[model samples]
Target: MKNTIYVLLLAFLTIPNLTAQDFSDIDKSPMDVTIIRNQNHSPMARVIYSRPSKNDRDIFGNLVPYGKVWRTGANEATEITIYNDMSISGQKIPAGTYSLYTIPNKTEWTIILNKNINIWGTASNYDSEKDLIRIKAPARTAAATIEDFSMAFQPIDNGANLLMGWDDTYVEIPFKNAE
Candidate 1:
């Protein structure tokens, strides 16, 4: 009985891939998170998104397409969490997590915050009725071509500008805390 148990243990240990985990390769578009902190170092807002590289492709109007709603990132739709009640472009938005969508154009972009956030990267899942706010942000030519889609926060008085850039186009949406 002891010998049989030892043999079984040895077979289990020698079994091919019996304990090995098969992990997939890294995602083509990498996920990222950006956050802004207030004067007290408390988080004001957070953005969870994926960065998609240019890969020598024409972004903006070509790949991303103008006048169409974009996921604002890759894979899943980009998500923004407002830590407090805030005003975006002078419109009030309650503190909550929402999906961030954008309709990019040559001169400007329409930034949309929707209550639905559980959907993947597809416009079919986007319901206009679920939209919370739609604000326009002016677009401009970047200093240089940005190889990857990126988002950042630039501190401003009483608020911050959520900056989005890809290729040679960029836009900034102002967000001010109501409280």
Candidate 2:
């Protein structure tokens, strides 16, 4: 019985190896997540996005272009999950997951949150009708260069600010908890 059990276990492990599927190489733009918590340590929001490196490319106007909607990240559309209802641009937004899109310009950027999720890219089939919130954030040159496209949350008194940085540019979208 002991011999039979040992043989069965070996076969089980070997079978998996034999049937194992090949995986493609790692993504050029790897996925990442960022979360922000309140002072009490309660989660406020979460962002899942792919970070594309600068790779010595001109990001703002040349590569990303101007006056066009971008997926806001690489590969997959960037997703943000809000844990609480928030106010943006003096409008209330209910807590939920939304795809983040942006129109980049030299002066400012139009940031958008859409109801649609799981979108692969915005080049072909981005539906503007599903947009829930649209806000403008002034673009500023970063004091230091950011090597990768990155998203982060900066805590505020009422809520927090969603910050996106790439190359030498950065933008901030302010969010305040709805009273």
lDDT of each: 0.93, 0.92
Name the regions of candidate 2 deviating beyond 4 angstroms: 1-24
* lDDT (10s digit) by residue, model 1, range 89-120: 78998999999999999999999999998789
What residue pairs are clashing in model 1? Answer: none
Measured by lDDT, the strongest candidate is 1
Instruction: Supply the TM-score for candidate 1.
Output: 0.87
**CA displacement after TM-score superposition, residue 96 of candidate 1 (Å):** 0.5
> What's the TM-score of every candidate structure?
0.87, 0.85
Clashes of 2: 0
> What's the distance in Å from true for residue 53, model 1?
0.4
Cα shift from native, residue 155, model 2 (Å): 0.8
Worst 10 residues of 2 by lDDT: 14-23
For model 2, residues 129-173, the per-residue Cα lDDT tens digits are 999989899999999999999999998889899999999999999
